[model samples]
Target: MLIDTHVHLNVQAFDEDRHEVIQRARENGISHMINVGFNRETIPSSIALAEQYDFIYSTVGWHPTDAKDMTPDDLEWIESLCRHEKVVAIGEIGLDYYWDTSPKDVQARVFREQIRLARKLGMPIVIHNRDAHHDVVQILREEKAAEVGGVMHCYSGSWETAKMCLDMNFYISFGGPVTFKNAKQPKEVLEKVPLDRLLIETDAPYLAPHPYRGKRNESSYVRLVAETAAQIKGISLEELAGITSRNAISIFGIK
Candidate 1:
C-alpha cells in the first residue's frame, strides 16, 4: 500500500467532501495519509482528522511563513498536542525564502526551535524548504536534527545537496513536480536517491500531479507520483509503493 507522507486534509479546499477525498485515496491504494498543520489555526483541524480516522495521522508546527506570529504559549500548546495518540511528528516546518512571509531571521529562529522541540520529544520532523536551502540545512546541522531524523517534503535541490541531507539522516520526498514534462532536477534527484531514502507525497489540495496539474490536488493522485517515481527508478508500481510505504513507516514511526 502507498502512504502519502505529506498532505493537508485540514485546509478549506477539502472541507466540502473531506471524507470523499480520503475515501478516494483509499480506493486508489493509499493506506495512510499524514495531515500536516503548519500554523496554530490548522493544528486543531489536523488533530481532528487524526481523531476521526485510524489511518490518518497529524503533525503540528508553525510554517516559516507564519514564524513571526508564533508565541511561547503556542509552542507549549504544540508540545501538549505531542501527547495525542495520533500526532506523529512536528513539522511542515522549515524555511521558505520565496514567499518571504516572515523575515529570514524569524524564519530561521522558529525553524531551529521546532527542530529542538522534535529532538526533545524524540519525534521526527517534516521539513518544508524552498529557496532557502543553505540556511535550512545549516540550521538543521546546528540543531543536530539528525538525532531525530525527518523527511524533506517536496524536496527542491540538487543531488549534491540531497546527499548532504541524507548524510544528516533525512529522507528526500518528491511530489507532483516530478510528473511535469520539463522537471529535470527532481527526476534526476529521484534516480540518484537510494531506494531506502525515497518517499512520495501529493501535498493534496496543492501540487497535484500531471493530467491533474494546476487543479485541486487530492491524496488519490499520489498514485501518479508513485507512477513517476517507479518509472524513473525502473521498478514496478507495487515495488515502488512497498518501498515508499516502508520508508514512511520508518520516518513517521507509524504502526
Candidate 2:
C-alpha cells in the first residue's frame, strides 16, 4: 500500500471531484493521505477533510508565504486547532525564499514560533523549504527540532542538506520532481537517503510525476514515485512501497 505523505486535497482544484479523486487513490493502493493546511484559512478545511475521510489526516500551520497575514493571536488559534485527533502534525510550515510574498525575517520568525509550538504540543512537523535552505536548516537546528521529528515534505536539496535534516531525525520525502528527466539533485538525494528514512508523496493538485507532468496531480500518482524510487535503488516496486509506507507510519504514528 502507498501513503501520500503530503497532499492538498482541500485545494479548490479538487473541489468538483474531490471524493472521486480520493476513491481513485484508494483503488490505486493509496491507503492513507496527509492533507496539509498552510494557513489559517485552510486549517478548518483540512480538519474537515480529515474528518470526512477515514484515511485522510490533517496538519495545521502557517506556510511561509502566508506569514505576512498572521498575527500572534492567529498562532494561538493554530495551537488550539492542533489538539484535534485528526490533526497529525504542525506544518506545511518553514521558509520559502522562492516567493517574496512574505519578508524573510517575518517568515523566519513565524517558522521558528510554529516549530516551538509543535514542540510544546509534542507533535511532529511538516517542513516546507524552498530557496531558503540554509536559513531553514539553521533555524531548525537552533530550535532543536530533533525533539519532535518530522518529514521534509517534497524535499529538493543536496545530499549534504538532506543529511543535515536526517541527522535531526527528519524523514526525506520525494515528489514529482524526483521523476523529472532533468531532476539531477532530487534523484541524487533519493539514492543517497536510506530507504528507512525515505517517504513518497505527490503533493497532489501540484507536483505531478512524469508522463503526467504539467497536469493536475493526485494521490493515485504516488505509485509513479514509488516505481521511480524502486528503479533508483534497484529494488522491486513492492519492496519500495512496503519500506516507504512503513516509514510513513513511523513518522505519522498511523496504523
Candidate 3:
C-alpha cells in the first residue's frame, strides 16, 4: 500500500468532495494520508478529517506564512493536540521566503519554537522550506531538532543541500515536483537520497504532478509520484511503494 505523507484535504478546495476524493484514494491503493494543517483556519478541519477517517492522520503547526500572527496561546493549543491518537507530527512548519508574507526572523522564531515543541513531545516534525533552504536547515541544526528528527516535506533543494538536511537528522521527502518534466533538482536529488530515507507525498490541493499539473490534486495521484520515483531509482513501482510507505510509517509512528 502507498502512503501520502502530505496532503491538504481540509482546505476549501476539497470541501465539496472530500469524502469522494478520499474514497478514490483508497480505491487507488493509498493506505494512509497525513492531512496537514497550515494555519488557524485549516487546523480544525484537519483534526476533524483524521477523526472521521480511520486511514487519515493529522499534523498540526503554524506555517511560516502564518508566522506573523502566531501567539503563545496557539503554541499551547498545538501542544495540547499531542495527546490526540491521530496527531502524528508537529508541522508543515518551517521557512517560506518565496511568499515573504512573514519576516524571515519571525518565521525562524516560530519554526524553532515548534521544533522545540515537537522534541519536547517526543514527536517527529514535518517541514516546509521554499526558497529558504539555508535558513531552514541552519535553524533546524541550531534548535537541535535532530532530537526528534523529521521529514522535509515537498523538498525543493539541491543534492548538496539535501545532504546537509539528511546529515542534520532529516528525511528527504519528494512530492509532485518529482514527476514534473522540468524538475531537474528533485529528479537528481531523488537518486542521492538513501533508499531508506526517501519518502513520497502528493501534497494534494497543490503541486499536482504532470498530466494533472494546474489541476486540483488528490491523494490518489500519489501513485504517479511513486511511479516516477521508481523509474528514477530503477526499481519496481511496488518496491517504491513499500519503501516509501515504510518510511512514512517510521516517521509518523503509524500502527
Candidate 4:
C-alpha cells in the first residue's frame, strides 16, 4: 500500500469531486493520506475530512505565506486540534522566500514558534520550504527541531542542504517535481536520500507529475511518483511503496 505523506484534499480545488478523487486514490492503492491544513481557511476543513474518512489524517499549522495573519489565538486553536485522534503533525509550516508574501523575519519567527510548539507537544512537523533553505535550516537548528524530527515536504534543495536536514532527522519527501524531465536536482537528491528517510507525496491540486504537469493534481497520481522513485532507487514499485508507506507511518505515528 502507498501513503501520500503530504496532500491538500481539504482545499477547494477538490470540492466538486472530492469523494471521487478519494475513491480513485483508494482504487490506485493509496492506503493513507496526510492532508495538511495551514492558516485559518483550511484547518477546520482538514479536520472535517479526517473525521469523515478512516484512512485520512490531518496536520495543522500556519503556512509561511500566511504568517502575518497567524494570531496568538490561531496558534492556540491549532494546539487544541492537535489532540484530535487524526491530527498527526504540526505543519506545512516554514519559510517561503519565493512568495515574499510575509516579511522574512515574520516567517522565521512563525516557523520557530511552530517548531517550539511541536517540541512542546512531542509531535512531528511537516515543513514547507521555498527559496529559504539557509534560514529554514538555521531556524530549525536554533529551534532544535531535531528532537521531534519531521518531513521536508516536496523537498527542493541541494544535496548539501539535504544532508543538513538529514542530520537533524528530517525525512526528504519528493513529490511530482521529481518526475519532471528537467528536475535534475530533486532526482539526484532523491537517489542519495537513505531509504528509511525517504518519503513520497502528491501535494494534490498542485505540482502534478509528468504527463500531467501544469494540471490539477490528485492523490491518485502518487503512483506515477512511486514509479519514478522506484526507478531512481533501483527497487521494485511494490518495495518502494512499502518502504515509503512504512516511513510515513513511522513519522506520523499513525496506527
Q: Which candidate is the best by lDDT?
A: 4
lDDT of 2 at 206: 96
lDDT of 1 by residue, 37-134 (tens): 88979999999989999999999999999999999898999999999999999998999989967899988889988898999999999999989888
Model 1 clash pairs are none
Per-residue accuracy of model 3 over 1-255 as CA lDDT, tens digit each? 999999999888998998999999999999999999878888888999999999999999999999999999999999998789999999989999899689989998899999999988999999999998788888988999888999999988899889888887788998898998999888999988999899999999999998899999999999999999999999999999999999889989998
Predicted structure 4: lDDT: 0.95
Candidate lDDT scores, in order, read: 0.93, 0.93, 0.92, 0.95
Model 3, residue 45: C-alpha shift (Å): 0.9
Model 2 poorest ten-residue lDDT run: 246-255
Model 1 CA lDDT for position 201: 95
Can you write out model 4's per-residue Cα lDDT over 1-255, one digit (the tens) per residue? 999999999888999999999999999999999999998999999999999999999999999999999989999999999999999999989999899689999998889999999999999999999998999999999999999999999999999999999999999999999999999999999999999999999999999999999999999999999999999999999999999999999999999
Candidate 2 residue-wise lDDT at 33: 96
Error of 2 at 139 (Å): 0.1
Query: Against the hidden reference, what TM-scores do the models get?
Result: 0.99, 0.98, 0.98, 0.99
Candidate 1 all-Cα RMSD: 0.7
